[model samples]
Target: MGTLDSDDLKSGVDLKSQTDDVSLVDERTAEQKKIDDWLPITSSRNAKWYYAAFHNVTAMVGAGVLSLPYAMSNLGWGPGVVILILSWVITLYTLWQMVEMHEMVPGKRFDRYHELGQEAFGEKLGLYIVVPQQLICEVGVDIVYMVTGGASLKKIHDIIWDGAPKIKTTYFIMIFASVHFVLSHLPNFNSISGVSLAAAVMSLTYSTIAWSASIHKGMQQNVEYGYKGKDRAETTFNFFTALGDVAFAYAGHNVVLEIQATIPSTPEKPSKGPMWRGVLVAYIVVALCYFPVALIGYYMFGNEVDDNILISLNKPKWLIAAANFFVVIHVIGSYQIYAMPVFDMIETLLVKKLKFKPTFALRFISRNIYVAFTMFVAITFPFFGGLLGFFGGFAFAPTTYFLPCIMWLAIYKPKRFSLSWCTNWICIFLGLCLMILSPIGGLQNIIKKAKDYKFYN
Candidate 1:
């Protein structure tokens, strides 16, 4: 979405420094060569930094943003705000670290996270670990997208056609997936940056709507405050569980590297300037989008907040329709951004391992089929909120928190017990702690909720 043994390896290998060697240029295998032509154009160097910033912003601020109020409620305002700020600073640092590490290996470009892992760990171990978690986080997020998008569509359906038959969420999921299938034909990750920018705008628009609604409702209702020490306040387990949601809220690290690689860098002029600028701009935008909705939603609804803040509102039909429309559009674009990595991994595997030539028809068919598979799974298990916890705690936390720290340790081998070393381990320890506890909390919540759960309900 986002580690390892030591001692059996070398230190400071300097992947980029080795680029001066004449033999390594364009060292593409036949398989790589074939796939290169088949896949869509992916270089983003010609792209403006604003578009890159938009892509990063949208990728980080999807369904996870909706859960922030609930996360805030669990930890209380003080703790929640503190955690959000900390998560932002730490994740931004790690993201830049990743970008910096990416720059280190100019000799062989790492367009993917697993490739970085392999260089750091010295085997396919990186591939094995990074690939699955990345897929799980991305696909899991996509499933949540469908789930939320279906719910939005169903709401509109009920409003516009008051006497119509009730359709299952599964059908809505299929409809969303069908649309995704059509959009999936657009080649590669770089081409979609503009779409991602538009999606980011939608996200900001809906988030603003949610925030405004929370404020108006908070003003109108004489709701009681549960600052702390209340019966509905979070238990220790709930706090950890909330951390999972918050962790995933910052889970763009998994795709950041992939997005970076798409930026076209010439030998004479590297793309680092635009990349760093874009990343910083993106985080600033993320903070702007996340904090207000969370603070206001928790302020409005307290511990009773819905997993999605939109569903918690009681607004006019027109306003609801507009908000939901934005959400559906945002998720549609978000799904493609996340799914691109998975498609790349599968296509690469097919070409390299099975000796399958990467043809246009094959790429088109395989990717659409993969989209269908994701949709099928979402339809089958529409446990939207529970899936968020599972994916966040199990996949996003490690990818965002644990492994990045481990990778930092491996790459730099910072002075033992120094501040840098201590900080990294602290992050890793926190990551492991959340990884274990949050899932247990998440599962407990899932099991409790499952008692009344029904398929396509």
Candidate 2:
């Protein structure tokens, strides 16, 4: 982030500054025997810097690596590269809109998404655009991670048991839920950030080293094993499917905002510029990481990428070890990042809003209940293909392509309204097209596979 001018220094107010201003503007609400338990927490300080970096990495790492092969197959390697770059550019532009939306508000950055939705687009529209979209998108991400973690679990079972396990996916979900159970309750910001940092580094290192190896091998194959094409299908990308992956890939921006809000300083001139500096850094990182894999995955595997990138790589015995290590790391981090909010929301509803007393027993029960609920998605047992495609194809597009623009327009007042706003509307149109196509293709693919249970069964 960049340093602000003297004027920015004057206006930039953080949580403490907001509270101080509140003391002057409204006295009673500010001084009512207050203690900050952080259950009903304000955004933390210094959060934006780390959050921006973490989310940029997280957004890039999650969907692209594993899902690259599958998405590229439909669109072709060249088109996939084109779309990913295009998406990255569009994503950065829209994210700029989002940041402006936040900066316009001047405080609490995101006090209430719905309220911002109202402010940005007016009451009825914000409710329609911002509220439903965020709720669905956030929950949808939860489901994607659950399913991703479950896929890794099923893969583990195959490795350990030398065969798929009975009630395989259900068992996998349970295992996934068990681990996330610990992470969601954890409130330590630094610990989470540390893990996020390490995971980001580890993922980058492993992916780069492994992908480079794959590229080297690919070069060898091109020269030595020329034209002995493996059996691969011609993938026709349903735009909705591609868009779904796009949305998921560019997510964590919301989480980035949350992290920024939590930073312990006022919204004053930070050590850096919030707009260009923070976002520019994020944009550079994502493009470098995701584009290569999307290209390589398509180049190597054709259409068999499945849900994870490693599947497409199908590396020799050596790289598989590193791949396994990262898959575990991905699942662990994904679970923590996605599920913690669900726990927080549930906590707010139960203990705060419901006026129920917080009890250790209740906490334990709530954790167990949430863990159990994760089962609904995975209970079909040992099935990854159907669920992954269905959600990736269905929910991911709306979450990605459509939601950000909607949220931006709905939440923040714009600088230039008339002609400039049309870009958002244009994005909405494209997003809708994407949402419809991706999910339809994914579900169709899943349905066909399920119907052909003849061989696998």
Candidate 3:
């Protein structure tokens, strides 16, 4: 009436288009689902004890096995084990903060990490910091595993040949890694969940079995790799510094969240409460799964601990072979599963932004590029030397230490900062302090790696 004014017309336009914007978002999401690569680390069924436990081993155990020796070598047993335990505690604190964030925005499907970041820290912050952090963590993890696997190959080669391989071993890792992806269950996840679980079980079983056997065989005592001792002060400094890598081994809380989101609960309604349930159980299970192996491995190779402990063992030929088998399987599964985001970053730039979906041939070419990039970055670097420091300092650095208290402040705004709140507060503060310390280990390890390459060039 009264010839509806400009304000009225503007309001009408706004009301009319709100639905359109939402619909547009839905359309875009649906389109995204069509192309493979939507999930990173979720299993199809809400698996039970096996799923929760296996994921824990797969996610947390890799770095621990490889890096415990090196971590303990500098820090020695007392400092190393204590730091490893403390790092787990810190990670658990950050992990709860992660869960707290999801609670804040329950209605929206806060599936992707960036979405969680968007809800917690606003859109721009999520885009700039959280997402980038996730990408960096992922890339860093890629570097760690690829390097470790390559080094494992080198180790096996050297052992078999009675020294380092005559062959250009990097080429084998590249080819083997590439073919593994091709042969693995394709991009869809349900197919691979069983294998992932199986790999985790086999690796865990083989690790424990081999280690227990070795222990009985009197292989558990500390053995020197014969390197000159570090100065007392320098070694002490390095030991405290190496906590970062141990923290890194304990930093797979992200994967746990992804897992928690997937596994169905036994409770009729699937409440978030601890029925000793999926996500909650996952947190504890992963911790227990990791602790013993790390402790035992450190015990086996004190001060000489390098990275992967199994390879450190002076054992029967078959035991080393079995351990190597499990490690290789573990690495391959991890690579295939985690390789998505790397591809996503590339595709987002090319297909979505550039508006051209690559042909199958083009996609294959991209995969090759990824493999080449992975091998070079890993092998040319520490071959897993700096892995513990990198993840501990970077991925876990932000997520575990700083995020919880800030997230609580942002979302819950608790007044007295209840016991629940205080726990998170300490975690956040401790995480920040530890994160500050996390990189020193990495820097020294990088230097160590650079200085010695295969005892040759």
Candidate 4:
């Protein structure tokens, strides 16, 4: 009888222990669920494929397009066209790779770029490899957008008022950044879809105005098709910098997985289908916006064009002003598109890593600080062309051009010397070259600009 009683007691204790373990797991999971639910990237998963379209368009086609003509001037006719077309093809293939990889692991989705990195590179190494590069790319873009938005606004003020007392570009940047202070708090990607769509439309509109206006102005007198640099060494440096500019223009890839995370997915029909559809449409728009602006703007203005095409076309006063305004609206949306992921990373760190409560106050304070930081950088060093090249080559090259390819080779391990393998390798090699060379040129350009530039002017 005593043995029977002891057995019952032991069984009861074992059951109780199992129950406690299950309860603990449930609690932890529930807490995680709350955090995921609160995060901007994972808060919603109902975005349509077309959301991918405009969000991508908004993300991809920003102020970088304005500089394509400038890039062409350094690259010249043959190299410029070849590089431009090749970039379009390579980036498009890489983008498709990302979309396909989104749901590659059955029943699991790589929701963020870093999450995908973690899958390919292991937990610690993945974060180290992807997070810094991704942060630099996204944050660098926001800074550039600050300069673009402010510059466009200043352009408008200058054109309309025409020699009225000049407002410092610093004030204009602050004014541009103020919009983000409000928009940044919107919580997630899906929430900002409307803003992104508007920005995408504005991108197309302004791009059209840019090329059309160049045509209207006709070729400038004494336009030189030769490189703008004064000597061979300068010309070579400019060529490197121009490569970065093209890299910068195709940077939508940085945000592809995050955008896909917003789309609804199921076992039977994955998110990639709709996401690809949207990407196709977006790419079409990108081609339309990019090719004409680069080719026509260069054809007409040649080496003398400003970094931003809109700045060069000052004639038809009202149209140029309108184009500048469109640029402002487009960049406002682009800023949020880029800023959303950074917010996600910050919130994730605070809530998950630091154990801070995911409260409105935390989000408000953190996001405001980010906006202010980017605004300060933009105001201090508003060297638009130089900034593009530096960020483009240093950060954008890896993420947009070849990071996806590297991730693919690591994950898929395609057949040796097969088409996929060769293609990815080519991309990886070219991307590495861009990463190494362009920053040198960009830094030189920045130093050259700083010689004449007064801080905060």
Q: What is the TM-score of each candidate against the true structure?
A: 0.89, 0.77, 0.78, 0.93
TM-score of candidate 1 versus the correct structure, residues matched by position: 0.89
Ranking by TM-score: 4, 1, 3, 2
Q: Kindly report which residue stretches of model 4 are placed more than 4 angstroms away from their true locations once superposed.
A: 1-29
Q: Write the per-residue lDDT of candidate 3 for residues 1-457, one digit (tens) a residue.
A: 4798999999989987977877875786667654434333322434454454555556655634555556666666666667767776666556666654543544333445666666668988866766666666666776667765666666666666675437665655675566555733254334556656765665566557544754555544556533225576566447545667666666455454454444443324341333124345545555544556666665565555545566566567666766666677776656654555455456556666776664556566766777777667665554454654645476667755666567667667776658866776777777777777767666766666666577213
Tens digit of per-residue lDDT, candidate 4, span 143-168: 98999899889989998999799999
* Residue 410 miss distance in model 1 (angstroms): 0.6
- Whole-model lDDT, model 2: 0.57
lDDT per residue for candidate 2 within 317-392, as digits (tens), equals 3465466556666656655555545555565577766866655566667756776666555454234444454655
| lDDT (10s digit) by residue, model 1, range 60-163 | 88866877987887788788888888888878877877877776765456778888898888777887888778877888888888787887888778766778
Instruction: List candidate 3 segments past 4 Å from native.
Output: 1-53, 76-78, 160-165, 180-185, 219-229, 260-276, 279-289, 304-307, 348-351, 358-365, 382-384, 387-392, 452-457
- lDDT, candidate 1, at 387: 58
lDDT of each: 0.78, 0.57, 0.59, 0.91
- How many residue pairs clash in all the candidates, one count each? 8, 33, 13, 0
Q: Against the true structure, whose TM-score is highest?
A: 4
Stretches off by above 4 angstroms in model 1 are: 1-24, 27-31, 40-45, 162-164, 220-222, 227-234
Q: How many collisions between residues are there in candidate 4?
A: 0
Lowest-sum lDDT 10-residue window in model 4: 384-393
